[model samples]
Target: NGQSTNSNEKKLAFQNIPRLPREVTPFASFTNVIELDQRGPLFQGPGAKRDTGRYKVRPTDDDSMKRAKKFSMEQSVKYVLVRQQQHQQRAQLDLIKKQQALLLMCR
Candidate 1:
C-alpha cells in the first residue's frame, strides 16, 4: 500500500514509486519489480509521466501464465479484426450491384 498528496494536498494512494540509486540500476534484476507506481502521473499533469512502465520480476511459472493470458487476449483481438475485415469485404461486394444500378439510373 502507498499514499501521496495531490495538488489539493489531499490524501491519496499510499503507494510510492520505487527507484534505485543510479549506482544500483545495473544490479537491479529485470524480473524484480523495482518500482511500484500507481495513479501518480495521471494526477501529475503534463509534466507527469503518462503510461510510465514499471518493472517487476515474477516467478517463471507466473511469467508463463501471464504470457498465456496475454497471448489469448491478443489472439482473440486478431481473430475479431480478421472476422470484421471479412464481413466488410462481403458487404462491399454485396452492395456493388446496387451501386451500379443506382449509377446507371443516375446516368
Candidate 2:
C-alpha cells in the first residue's frame, strides 16, 4: 500500500511539471480572422477614371437629347390614351349602374 501511494505521488508531480515555452505557446489552438470589404461598385469599368470629379458637367450630344425628348413625348401620349380609356370605362360602368337601378324601381 505504501509503494502504491508513492507511485501515485510521482505521477501527480510529473503532471504538475512546468511545460517549456514552445510547448505552452498554444499556437495550435489560436485562430486568426481577416475580413475583406465587398461593398463598392461591382465592376469598375473604363468610365470610372473619368468620373472622379463631382461637379464636372459632361455635355450631352444633340442626337441623344433629341432621342430623349422624342421618348418623353411618346410616353406622354401613351399616358393620355390610357387615361381616356379609363374614363370611358368608368362612364360605361356608371351607365350600367343607373340602368340597373331604374329596372329595380320599375319592378
Candidate 3:
C-alpha cells in the first residue's frame, strides 16, 4: 500500500512538470500557417508611406451628383407607382358605390 501511494505521488509530480513553450513545440508550425498583414490603412498613421499599388479613390463630386440624381429618379418612380395604385383603388371604390346605388334604386 505504501509503495502504491509513493507511485501515485510520483505520477502527480510528473504531471505537474511544465511543458516547453508553444513556439518550441511541433504545433507552433500550424500557428503561423497563414501570416496576414494585420495592419490596415486605418491603422497606418497619417504621412505613412501609402501603398501606391492600391487605389483608395473616394466618391468624387460627379459621382455624388449622379447618385443624388439616381435617388431622386427612383423616388419619383416610386411616388408615381403609389399614386397609380391609389387611383386604381379609388376607381374601384367608386364603381362599387355606383353599383350599390343602382341596386338600391332597383329594389
Cand. 3 TM to true fold: 0.44
What lDDT does candidate 2 reach at residue 62? 62
Model 3 lDDT tens row, 1-107: 99999999999999999999978987676544677786756566787987779555567966988999999999999999999999999999999999999999999
CA shift of 33, model 1, Å: 66
The C-alpha local distance difference test score for the whole of candidate 2 amounts to 0.88
Model 2 spans > 4 angstroms off: 1-60
> What would the TM-scores of all predictions be?
0.39, 0.44, 0.44
The candidate, 2 or 3, that scores higher on lDDT is 3
Over the full model, what C-alpha lDDT does candidate 1 score relative to the true structure? 0.77
The lDDT of each candidate is: 0.77, 0.88, 0.90
Better candidate number, 1 or 2, judged by TM-score: 2
Question: Global CA lDDT of candidate 3, please?
Answer: 0.90
Task: Write one digit per residue (lDDT tens) for candidate 1, span 1-107.
Answer: 23433532442333344667966787755665578668645455677657768767579978898999999999999999999999999999889988999999999
